[model samples]
Target: MKPVRIKRRFSLGLGGFTYLFVTSFIGLGAISSQTNLLFWTFGLMVGGMIVSAIYSTAMMMSLRITRVLPDHGAVDEPLLIRYELTNRKRMIPAFGLVISELDGDDEYLRGKPHGWVLHCGPRATLQAQTVGWPTRRGAVHFNRICITTTFPFGILSKSIVVTQPGRVLIYPKMYRLRRKALWDIHSRDMIGSRNSNEGGGSEEFYGLREYRSGDSMRHIDWRHSARAGKLVCRDMTRLTPPKLMLLLDVRHRGAWPYDTAERALSFVASLVVQAYMEGFDVGLAVAGTPCPTFTPHHGRIHRTRILHALGELDFKTDEPGSWSTHRARDVNWMVIHAGEIDELFGPPGAHHLSDAELDQWKLNHDGKSSRVNLVTRPRRGVLIADFSEGVS
Candidate 1:
């Protein structure tokens, strides 16, 4: 835990001084005039000011602060930062404990519009909650905390500065890929030579045939060959699909801004999940100041990596020229875009398309690559939903 230094605003101190000055002047005038009523009024004003100062100081001194932050949140999601203020002194009731966070580049700096107030009993602990909505992805650090009180009398205001350091990582939204698009990649036509021979060597032995020139010596059945009076090699074959490298273009391409780039990030996340379930070695990349690369893997580790990356995605406007530079040569490439597939696939090569054009192309051809298929499809219906209803 770090130390929270206390400082009173100069304006507040000036107000306190002005209050004392006026009371003192009235008290002096009454003493000079020898008026009992004026003297009593002077005494009350002086006493009220003294009591307000002592109580205000005591309220600030007796409070202890702590913060609670969420482990993670998606872009544009509401993140709650709870401020726990414990009242150590029993006599003073804690009220108007305004807990606010200082603003950052992506967040509004004037502080959130609302705060929590608690009227604490003696030795009671009160918690004040402040929420922030992260508009972008990345780490958000809050360097300042303010705890204020106007309790007992509204005339005197007292506040303390709490220098607590905290941060939250805003992630990219996850969106789902179309089932038809996913199925197209997983179809039988996409199978290759390796798919037929992947696990065959480990299975039950099949009868041998004449040894081929390149056949491995380990596969030779000496006893069987001797009995047959001929050299023979084991026959084995198993089906396996070609590994695919799915690259998602999360960059905004045109005039139509689609509810922030976060939506595209969500769609990328959904595609990664779908690809993993279908047994594809998936890698993820995004366009930005520093693009991210997730090495291809399968199973739970891959899922976790992909989701984690998505959670931290930030939008970048700069384009990466073409998919050729980003994609791995041996692995099949699938580009997931949020706009028209044809325009998005600019100067395409071996990439499978998942936009609208790909869908239309599939109708004419039997999923075979005449020209590399570019599927163009609309953004997921669920992704286009009104997040505003919940955001504000």
Candidate 2:
């Protein structure tokens, strides 16, 4: 475990101020009227306030918080961030502990996210979870964790600010790809039906050879062995899934560059998931950005690598360059560009999708109808870097 830097802060809450005001008024009355009962009540109220403040301070000071966050998240999905809260003191039990994020990307989040714990006994650790809905793609930074409490009485509140900076890569917004959209790709190649030269599964027969000592008994051919007077084994071929190579061009081609680029990214993201579900080896290459080339492969790790690279793309650092059209044989290439598609680079028969055709390929969140139009509504000459800075 790394060392956590904590800063303690004390605050007089609204209830504290109200209680103090009423107690002061009663103290004044007791002094003016010289009533023993009123004086006792005033003293008791003051004592209670002091005790509440002390209890709250002690409880807050004896607490420790550690954040357990995921490295990646998807847009519109619940990002469950957890925290481990431990009561350090032997006797002071913490209650009503509220852990919140401070100086983070709150605009990208759906609501004011916070974790709560009803009670954490002394010398005990408890885990609390909070959910955050990310609105868009990119990196979300968490600067600090604030643990506050107004325990025992709501008179005073105390907080401990822990400087635990972290980041989560937010993948582009994904949607269900309609079956019609897949039919178009299926027509291009016999997906997942091709046989590879590797010998493994029983899908296709590769050849026959002498049976090895450790060969499976089911693979031995009895008729061939009897004729040859030696044990023979069948070598079966493994089926190779089809491949999808996505070329994402996010260069500034028109007025609404940022929105157009975002839409193209989301479309590619959805297609990546769809292709993986259909058993296609997927690869992604981003134009103008400094992202590295991703080769066509099929696996959960490969898919995550592509998505992470997409999330880290920044137009501000993009260079002026043409799209790489290093076409691989048998790999179905799909060029997805933002705005105009005039400068796209691919084979003549390669699939192409521009801003106009994005909504057609995407399905709604509930998997019902076509996606709503995501075209930006006239942001005249707004630079992509400026727009991203404003959003963050």
Candidate 3:
């Protein structure tokens, strides 16, 4: 077991100040009036401050704290971090212990919050819970906690800095793809229905069945139906995965460059989940200095890998210089790029920015990209630095 780090600090609190003030007044009266009673009163007041200091310091020193973190955390989600606080002293109990992460006034810091322990019996252990929220997807960390207490006497307060190494990976916040809006994509027939072999389609043709009402007109085997003098639809085994290539383009293209980039990343996360669940063999392409790539595959493990990689993206760091042939050469790639050219990185906690707040973030459109792509697609295996870069 590692040693529990304990540092002590003392500050005059309400009760301490009142006692000191009275003592000072008594000392003044005793000196001027030659009153021995006032002298005794002054001595008692000074002694009380000394006692308060000792008691408060001991309460803080006798306690040790260890943090219990969850398996993982996610952006924009509440994660509970547990603190097990134990009092080591046999005779004295500790009270009003506040354990909190020290946050600077700078707006970019997104880390843990504070927790409190109201009471701990002598030589006993107590468990307290703290809720931490992550505002960004990536590595979240904590190094020290500010533990404070004014135990025994409300007058004297002591705070100590407890140092601990802490780190947790935060997965990207996923949004469900709006099915209603996606209907437009489906209607445009942009979602490829792979077909080639005589058995036809990705699924092998099993046989034919009488056309039911509301059946897709496209499924009708007209030749077979004519031969049988009845309306028939082809039945095919549902196999062969739908192949999709997700291209994350980081170039900012429009006015709300920061908002657009983050929103695009979120949308990408949602699409990955949606595609995988729908049986799409999904591959990922990212433009980064050391870009992380995944071949189109299937399984829950693959999904986890994707989410983990997605969480680590620092958009300002990576750039897809040119499109190069990645793993699969035949992917029907959908390239989603946030091609806004401005380099303004938003607040670190910008991921938590509300719509109203984001709207306020917009400034003069000093956008370098002559044009913006709401979203775009590229040919399978073809690389384009930007959609406007023209397909190879």
Candidate 4:
């Protein structure tokens, strides 16, 4: 591991700049009027600005910075990246220190990429945090960690740039999926495949939320709602969904629209998560993009493997999508952009989840949608993510 490099920088803040302007004005007046009071005030203001700048810069330079990346980062979710600052000097202490990310062109960071710390004793290590919500799924590379401060008088701001090479793999955003008709239909096929005593059989009380349109009246928490003065519906997670294999059939027309592809990938990620939670064996078959072959299986490892393939999905937009035309046995395929399946094996579609229907289903509109699901729609004229050319 190469040693981290730290560089210190300083600049005049708004207050410092105003102080300079006032000092100049006062000095001019002093010279014109030959007034000792004005001259004294001008010299004091200039000295104060200088003292503020020097103090802030010295404190910033004395600190050594390091960072801690999360185990895994997901798209559009708050991921806390930690920073540790070590005050190297034996006599001096650090105060009002902040750690920030040095981002490039990607604008996924929601708020200002900085975290604050009240104080750090001499030779003590202090921890701070910066929150980053990845807008898209992929590698989040950190070129540097910027530690900035405007301590004491707050007249000048100083920044210390540390060349820290850090990056993390971020999974695609999982959407809330309430639609269970497709899963219930295929679960019967999986019946007797696993012993009744082996898998999760009964529904468990999960959480409480606002009542939806089609919720069972028996499931409603009447007493709790009456106490809280609102209709609170009871949510549960005791039932399993089903096993599914995703067959992606997409073809690039000309140029790949970035927006369209992102939305499509997000949709896939959401489905995989919902299935896994419901104990579904999830797999993938992409036509164009070069991704790993994930056989249908159920488990945390299997889900990670599928998500890793989705994150590494990258290819020229002009190149059409490709996948083995041969179909897998003993598995129900969930077709996304999969072309006509005349020569293919398995059912044409165990469940055809139309993107249009997903878009039409307003999840927030009292519909019985799953809390752990994703909802996204591609822009007009935007198409193709791991798809091949021409009609399937």
Model 1 residue 349 CA deviation (Å) reads: 8.8
**lDDT ranking from best candidate downward:** 2, 4, 3, 1
- All candidates: TM-score: 0.58, 0.86, 0.65, 0.71
Q: Is candidate 1 or candidate 3 better by lDDT?
A: 3
**RMSD (CA, angstroms), candidate 4:** 13.0
Ranked by TM-score, top first: 2, 4, 3, 1
Instruction: Give me the runs in candidate 3 sitting further than 4 Å from their true place.
Output: 1-5, 34-40, 103-112, 180-241, 252-256, 276-281, 318-326, 329-332, 340-392
* Residue-wise C-alpha lDDT for candidate 3, range 1-392, written one tens digit per residue: 24356577888867777877877888999999999888888888778778878888877888788877676677678877788888999999888888887742122235447878888999999788888767767777666768888766677788988777676677776654433222223333333345444443436777778988877888999998999999999877553555666666664433355766676667667778877777677777765334577878888899878888787777665454333544665445555555442112321111111222212222224422212112323333222222232111
Better of 1 and 2 by lDDT: 2
Give the higher-lDDT candidate: 2 or 4.
Answer: 2
The sequence of per-residue lDDT tens digits that candidate 1 reaches over residues 281-339 is: 67766543245576566778767766776665444435453334444434555565655
For residues 1-392, could you state the per-residue lDDT of candidate 2 as single tens digits?
33269899878878878988999999999999999999999999999988987888888888888888887899999999988888999998888888898866866777757878999998999889999999988888887889888878887788889998887889888877665455345553453347888887778899899998888999999999999999999999987777778888765644565778788888888888888887788888777667777878999999888888888877666475444546445676677878777432555445566755665655556565443222221343111110111100
Clashes of 3: 11
Better of 1 and 3 by TM-score: 3
Worst 10 residues of 4 by lDDT: 383-392
Superior by lDDT: candidate 3 or candidate 4: 4
